[model samples]
Target: MHDPAPMPEVQNDEEVPLLGAQRLGFSAGSQRLIRDIDLTIRAGSRTVIMGANGSGKSLLLRLLHGLIPPTEGHVEWCERPLDTAARNEQAMVFQRPVMMRRSVAANLRFALSARGIRGAERAAREAEAIASARLEHLVNRPARVLSGGEQQRLAMARALACAPRLLFLDEPTASLDPASTHAIEQIIDQAHDDGVTIVLVTHDAGQARRMGQDLVFLDAGRIVETGPVAQVLDAPSSAAAQAWLGGRLYLDPTHSSQT
Candidate 1:
């Protein structure tokens, strides 16, 4: 974890690719958003995607998770195609988290019940998730009535309830205060220790350094560089990545910062 290498040290686990996107591309009404990408995500490593606005980072993540079909190429999870059943082992948390109109505990229950869990087992799971996110006192409060930071924590707890083998985080801490962000970072570290493959899309350099060993750098709908975090952030191989990592490539700074 100290070295920011592109490929994590291979583990003793069996040969199984957690995620693979080959020659992936996406288009909408003659506008291509992402193009000709190939990526393979291994288990037990945190691979972060970093780039400027319109660099196709978010779009590429969605494609890899099988939320949207690629106009070209395909995605695979664990040797199988990225179908619904295959995707169930993975979970994603978006930048602006949306919660139900119900109580915080109710939201957790709904997520667990979706995976066919119910009753006392489900209630215990909800309590544990809330405590993990430091929201135990807010369990009975309405989800929507909570503060912005609280809502994001709930989104995180909900994602953890499923115990996914792979987790996709798209700016999960984008709108949070420092305390909230730090709390979620600890939770993610815990999840990583529990053997969940983590793919995070973020622009914060420090966050990248902490969580990312390998990096996926995208620009203008194409992957500009794919390698170790040190190479991509410290000594970026591509001009776009270098400028981005150095904080000098923004066309408009406001659009680039998550906050």
Candidate 2:
């Protein structure tokens, strides 16, 4: 089959902020979920966050994305706090998308409307997003009732419709079939080519190897190893990461709780 067309670059109003966390920490009551995270996400990088379950991968993503407030540290973008302006330039997609009860087309329209695009302009944006996601046939279907793969495509389409400069995805293909996963990865690649900085969290090591330029490996709420994809995955610097990559770092079931 021919390669899928890349997404056309759409320049945003301003550049994506250089995201960084300074001494970041987050606690859930007495349990510290993340601790002392000092990291920088440079502009135009495809950064992937990977770790064992309960190792603070998701928590760190949420904290950095400004979805949850940090307990003892701060996150900033472009030397400023992660306030409304910074947040406005970002978008996120979760594993299981929560869709509106309306039709697929209406759901996408809602996202565009929220971004202040309306009338014929909204229609054009929606059309483009739908075509990119290959959701034309599903336009009139109820969004929530579509199959899992279709719902995910719609969710990604809706997020992309807003023209975000930064995109965060948390295990977006965690439960997808092979074909569906491939579709999602292509969409992600197109977004990256279009100048959207991407940060993704995934447990699938192969997925990380395929999509990541930079790798961040976490263990017990700390960054055990981080570097370029091949370096960290091939020549791990930490025992924990080595153990993980070697498939010997399995945790007990009783301690199973997500980060």
Best by TM-score: 1
Clashes of 1: 1
Clashing pairs in 1: 6-228
Q: Give TM-scores for every candidate, taking all chains together and pairing residue i with residue i.
A: 0.89, 0.89
What are the Cα lDDT values of the candidates?
0.82, 0.83
> Among these predicted structures, which one has the highest lDDT?
2
Candidate 1 lDDT tens digits, 1-259 = 0122233222224446778877788978677788778778888878899889878888988999888889999998887888888888999999989899999999999999999999889988888899988997898999999998889889988998888999999988888888888888998998888888889999888898888877887776766677777767777766677677677764433222231
Clashes of 2: 0
TM-score of 2: 0.89
Residue-wise C-alpha lDDT for candidate 2, range 41-117, written one tens digit per residue? 77788889888877888889989889999998899987899998888788999999889999999999888988789
Task: Give all candidate RMSDs, comma-separated.
Answer: 5.6, 8.1
Candidate 2: deviation at residue 157, Å? 0.8
